[model samples]
Target: EFIIESRDIVGNQRVIGDDAFVVEVEGPSKPQVSVQDRDDGTYLVSYNVQRTGTYHVRVSLDGHQIAGSPFTAQFHPGLVMAVRCTGVGRGLTRAYAGENARFTIESRDTHRNKTTSGKKPFVVTIRGILQVQVHALEGDNGEFHYSYRTPRAGVYFVGVLLDGVDIGGSPFKLTVDPGPAHANGCSASGAGITGGYTMVETFFTIYSRDYYGNQRTTGGDVFSVEIGGTASADMRMRDNENGTYSVAYTPMIGGDYFISVMMDGVHIQGSPFNIASDPMPRESYLEMYRSMEPTFKEKMEKMLLGGDVTGVKDRKKANSRRGKEAAQQKSWVLNIKLLDANRLIPKDTTVDGTYGTGLVQSSDPYVVFTMGSESVRSTTVLKDLNPTWNEEMKLPVENRLEKLKVEVMDEDLQDEDDSMGTAQVSLTDLVIGVPKMVTVKLKELNEV
Candidate 1:
């Protein structure tokens, strides 16, 4: 039933008299409808549906359709047979590998009554990354179970068949997660060149192990390095041929550097190590400068004017050039609004072969705006297909020809975040002082 109020031209509620209103319903078999006049500027419409289909109910004022008319309603036949995982009466269900899962199929007649007297033999089958064994419970009606550990990780299909016909909610899907990483007995510490001079090389060591405390000899594990200081460093890691790994750090300028190490995307023990380096001696600094060829000095000077300084140079000239370059750089104020998305792939996977449902299945989307090496990100919009985020940012643009890259990613808890799509906008065409609204069409990563 729909409640519609009529209003006059001046926005006052108007009473629709009995003679002024008419109601008609069009459906599959032309359901009989009755109209009752309440005499208080209101009318009641009642209809008995005889068929299962869509119906269009139109309300007219006098001989014309009202402001809001022709509403649609759909009806389905009464519930027939329903099937679900034993413990789960309805909706989605999940189970882990090597665990027992039971399914219960409930049968109901057309009269909306449950009956098991004429139950037929039901077939249950499991298929996916790997097939598992499924068997019917002995002496149980419409009950079956499956127990088997999958060797691989992926989605699995569970199907229930009654009299060779698929029942309601057949071919249920489940997901399987990768096996545990067994990262229990790992250790990391500073091993070499705890302190050094600028441009000098230093190193550290990390010992990786599994949950059993046995050293991991395999080389598939990944390690990352992060350095924090005014000046950056060249950092890389190398396997020491033993179970331990060696990380090399070469300081670019003299200062204190904080080093952080991560294994398998997690921080290692005793991370954020501090290493101190002294400035190069005057003699050493001069020797490095003199080692350059005569023509190379001019190239070096040109690079230093652009903030790429290696050797010590005239401070006054370098500062003056830097000031000029800073003045020429443009700063942009951006008002970003993340509107919505369409046709996004599901990223959540489980060991039971069930993908996420409802909000869990939707993406926790966030936008990352990048220009050259500088990047800023908007706050995450949780579990929505049409997320609205009106955020603004101010950033300096060093290169006018560089395109602004926008990447949409889905945040995950168990693994690496997944990229949904990306878009690019050319900044050179945008007016400096004017704010322009742009609708970026997100495309797959490989799409140009």
Candidate 2:
């Protein structure tokens, strides 16, 4: 049996037997509806309405109009401005007659509204009489473009049409200059270290411009920089954290090194500067651990409270019990690895120096850990000093530590004492190379 089922209106919600839903509308005037009928009876239909006007969208049942809405189609007017006939060839006053010219269209409309089929149609027109063919853009944001050719080399007017109406008469000009031309320029600025280059790391300031004296820094184009040949990388001038780019390069030679800066893949021609790197002093690291020795012994004493042997050899028996308890409470351990080959290091006796490969020979010898793209906190959790290499390092969060970095620095000698140097290192001071990075993704511990 066929039922009207409360009637259906175009663009309105429709609920079918229990849970299914559908929206129905009358087809547009120019194109008929593209509908597909299911064996169960629901029809999947689609169509497009070309121009702006009030039209009826009818829902039908066996060729009879059951329900409908008066759908209104309107156009929105907005502005699209562009410089016409931009030169494209290597040399130019203007490009050749048939050559393809490139130009940028600056479209501005704070209110983002559809332009083609609203209540009011958007009107468009251009000056120059240059004979051109134009077409509407098919993308989401309403766009229209045109192509033209110089017929007899005289001035011309380009006109725009919208909803069969012409827009404001004045048009953008395209001066066809005869040519043999070229263009070029450069950029430069002062660069100095701020903060401690070793402990705090630093940034450099640079002011740059282009060949035509155009401020390239404001152009938002990215700039690439490479420090010492081995430690090379690229960065955008605009992406600098504070009007400066930060890169860390360890100068093995300890002298002035030249830095190369390139913009838009083309070297800025004359933007190279000499950066001085002082020699890194001898260094050593010390890590301490909070052993659970006493806590374990106290727990053993509590267990013996209920049981008693009247004369259980007081001193010797108590000592053995305390030792057993201390062993059981040892859960977390901390360790520090002393790395020094190029320089000598005095042992912390608590930390074992594993004479491993790159031990002291490489500047980046410390164990570094990172989360995705961000640095995580690192802390010393255990220390063991034996001829054997055995120690443990804890995660920073475990100790309620605010920072994740630890470094050893000594100026007078190759090794520094535990109390002589600083313990907390801020992650911000370290600039990691391009390929190496850390990123952290924390799942919400509990949903509010």
Candidate 3:
């Protein structure tokens, strides 16, 4: 059933009279139905189309005429579009009269190149704050169909508008070169070594080139070199004979460096050859030389101070306190990791080896101590079965006391135990003056 409402009068609706409509079908016609009523001086109506195929329906009431409904058995075809250019892609924007910028529109998706689906009767939407002018193309397929132009030099948004709604904002970039002021030749050079340090310098030769590569050898404006790194000052040059000019620099140190040349303050590629330091003398000490050069030493201190290799091979000799006897008496907590068999004895104990007498055992009851003493030591263990002994020990300073010797047998007793393990012991010196502690540990590699 179909119903109709009046747009001129609010809340006014009507049902057509039963005899007021005439319906016809292309093929065989079927029975139709209509309902009609009159209330409060307003008419009301409802009707239904029974048969399919092309049909015509006319509605009239009270001597009033209405438009007939002509129905065709077909689907709705929406909108389509095309775009064209008045000129080639080279100067699309140059064709502008007043503020109209020009551009070439290409299908964003390459797959749509052969598409004729929506080529005509479609809408175009340009997005951007700037005003844009476009011309609709007439043909279905062409390399560049649409011609778009812009008003000025700024970012512009362009896209397709369908059914009064925008599709996507595709971007286009426009660049305009103002052309060279004059021809400027790109040139460079380096600083000379005075004393032991080298310097850097640079210059330029202005040469103008046209869009066709024609050189303008005369009347090119002079540009300056931009200062960077250790360069203390900035300098520029004036055009000399022909187009060559000069600039200079004194490098802070010896080595490879870059001297950037510039125009006004804008950078132009003018980095020249390496600025080198005076050759270092053959027999000079590296440490002395670096120290004399404040900048060099400041850079390499972390590399030079890394290890403690001051010619003293023995640890005891290294930690010896020669001048003050009271300070020499200071005690350090040392971790003496003994051979597993040796842990039974107290750590830092002195161990003297009698090679011919064979292995030493924990039962030797040796005194444990630091590198400086013989008489001062910690409590000792009596045997291996009673393993693990600990004590704070003191060392003597009169002799070169590097190794914390573990004495297995006293010279007077002449008795040595044979159960010592086969692991060799390694001694590492601790840093001096840093109140440090040492722990002696033991691990048995080949279990006994």
Q: Number of the top candidate by TM-score?
A: 1
Mind giving the per-residue lDDT tens digits that candidate 1 earns over 245-352? 767777888888787777666766666577787765554433343335656655645554355444435744554465456334765444444433444555553342
lDDT of every model, 2 decimals: 0.59, 0.34, 0.36
Kindly report which residue stretches of model 1 are placed more than 4 angstroms away from their true locations once superposed: 1-92, 106-120, 139-142, 151-154, 175-181, 184-314, 318-448
Cα miss at 2, model 1 (Å)? 49
Each model's total of backbone clashes: 8, 36, 59
- The C-alpha TM-scores of every prediction are 0.31, 0.22, 0.19
Q: Measured by C-alpha RMSD in angstroms, how accurate is candidate 1?
A: 21.8
Q: Write the per-residue lDDT of candidate 2 for residues 27-113, one digit (tens) a residue.
A: 333545555544343555565554334444555455554444234434343543222112122211233333344322223232322
Give a tens-digit lDDT track for model 3, residues 1-448.
3543332234444333323333332323443545433433333444333332344444444455445444433212222222221123533323321233444343322222223334323354444445565676555432234556543333234554434533333222233222343223343322221122332232223333322233323345556554444334344455532323444444445455444555545544333333434433322223232223445543333334334543332422322332123233445344443221222332223342421223433354433343544445344445343333434454444432245544332222444433333222223322232122222332332111
Candidate 2 has a TM-score of 0.22
Q: Alpha-carbon error at 225 in model 3, in Å?
A: 7.0
Model 1, CA-based lDDT:
0.59
